[model samples]
Target: MSCVKLLNDFPFTFSREATYQVCEKVETRCSFLDKLGIHLAGIWICECSCGSSDLPLDHLRSDKGWSLPNRLCPCRGPLSILKKQLCSWSEYYEWRGISLDSPVALLLHWPLTMYQAIQLAFGKQLTNETTDELCIHYLGPERELYQTAVFGELHALLPGVRVHIDFVGPEVPHDRDGETISLSSYAHCMEANCSCKTPISTDDSSKITLRFHSGYYHDCYEELTKEFLPDLIIAPNAGIAAYKSWLPTIELIREIEVPTIFSDYCEEACHLAANCITSVTGTPLAIPVQLNPFRHPLAVEDSALLLPCYSNCFLFGI
Candidate 1:
């Protein structure tokens, strides 16, 4: 089937009331595929961004605002990384109408295999031995966690999937004896400066190729879409929220015509992406249902399916 047609046929209808039901359906379908020893492969986009409040006072005051170059705090820490640390997953759930004791809440602690199963059910999964490739774009300090999640989840679902991770931010920092040290001593991963293909193997024989590049939106778009074409995009609101404006990245996705699975942490970034996609595809998109005392949730007008997780966070495809 054509890629666009496949995306349009994804098995879930967007509805706040039926989000959990859709997740259950995905799980059931993926379970059936696993029993057949079938493996599916596709490229997925994973990205992170910081909250605007995390920006430093000076950086926020600059003519370019949060878009200023070398945007870091006085302590030499990336604001995006700091904001990630501050995000309260528990609070997010509380806002979603899910209590800690609820059975659905247990899904949060489910293994990455379950998550991958859900993802595989959304897009076309390959049955061949050819390694499935997943492309991840991350910024700030939480990248390691994001990488671990991606790897773990894929490993759970498809043990042979290959992962390509692109770290699009400043050098990771290390703290030793109260001194902060930048890992600049390590080789850079820019498409221009480094070899595009470098392989690292996991314990289970899954291979991962790692790359690092500047987090500037234009640079990231050039490398991800033009240099490394992916089948699916898994964009995180936090990563995209780092910028005051993410039109270029949104436009890049529209131009590439790749199926994207967006994770919404903040309502504003989610709305921006939904609106951009709506304009491109001429499909009306709306924010998800609002969770009281939190914020209006992001919802797409004609999504194939919508699954709300952790209350405020949502997963949907277009």
Candidate 2:
């Protein structure tokens, strides 16, 4: 099917409700997600101004902020890290909502496999097979304990809420590429910079429904479209109360009315897919966010070594 005809996944109509009759927090908003017993979890990764706060794994007693050159903390200081995450969606949303006049937008830079700041509420089985011993730092006792504690606390707070994680679009038969694809841990997976779709040698001819779990808007979704128009863009629900930085990338899809797949998986997958694909439009989903390691601007020798994992899934917002 032609890509244009195959990409339509993001809209549904709902009967309007009396806003004035609903509660303050409920009535002021205009979203139809409540019908599906779903809540819009806006994951805002904002450039903090005063920095909500961060206490690295090493230093937990004293609260700290992420350093600069990383995520711009509107908290006025960099609190995240090259590999470490600095904040949380819950904290970010609470603070940013009060700060912005109209709805605010943000840009999100996520490490496809290795999550730094943006993480799924319910932790997943994290895997790292790097040569360096420190690579296991993410899976250490302390980190695992942290994940357990985070989930424990969340489970207590959000009674029946589900948890999910997101990967660079679902693993297609095609190799994945991304923009600024970081090869820190799995550098050996590819050569310095080569262009050979290695691992993701999938049935490219077969169309797949690429999915994602996001708390962004259509404007940001369009950013990916402008860079590389994918088949369809999908998200669980919008009009959320979380996310200090709802990426403008997803928002772009809505603005352009790019057909999108809406899922209720914000509470399920890391990719924020939906519970059920109600709109069976035979739409194909593709996020033009892939990177070609073999084709990167690197030394020839290095490029030769990093060819195995050369995928198109390493791009901007995959």
lDDT of each: 0.34, 0.22
Model 1 misplacement above 4 A: 1-131, 136-153, 169-205, 224-227, 238-244, 266-273, 285-312
Please identify model 2 stretches exceeding 4 Å from their true place.
1-223, 236-252, 265-318
lDDT of 2 at 281: 20
Tens digits of lDDT, candidate 1, 105-200: 211222222233234334334321444565554333232322232233233234455555454443322211112111211111223323212222
- Candidate 2 scores a C-alpha RMSD against the true structure in Å of 22.3
- Candidate 2 residue-wise lDDT at 56: 31
Q: Residues 1-318, candidate 2, lDDT per residue (tens digit)?
A: 132111111011221121112212343222322332222211111111111134232321111222211122232211231233223333332332222211211111112222321123113322221210111001001111111111211111121222221222221112222222111111011122332112212232211121221222332233334434433332322212233233343343335544333221112222322111112222333332222111111011112222221111122221
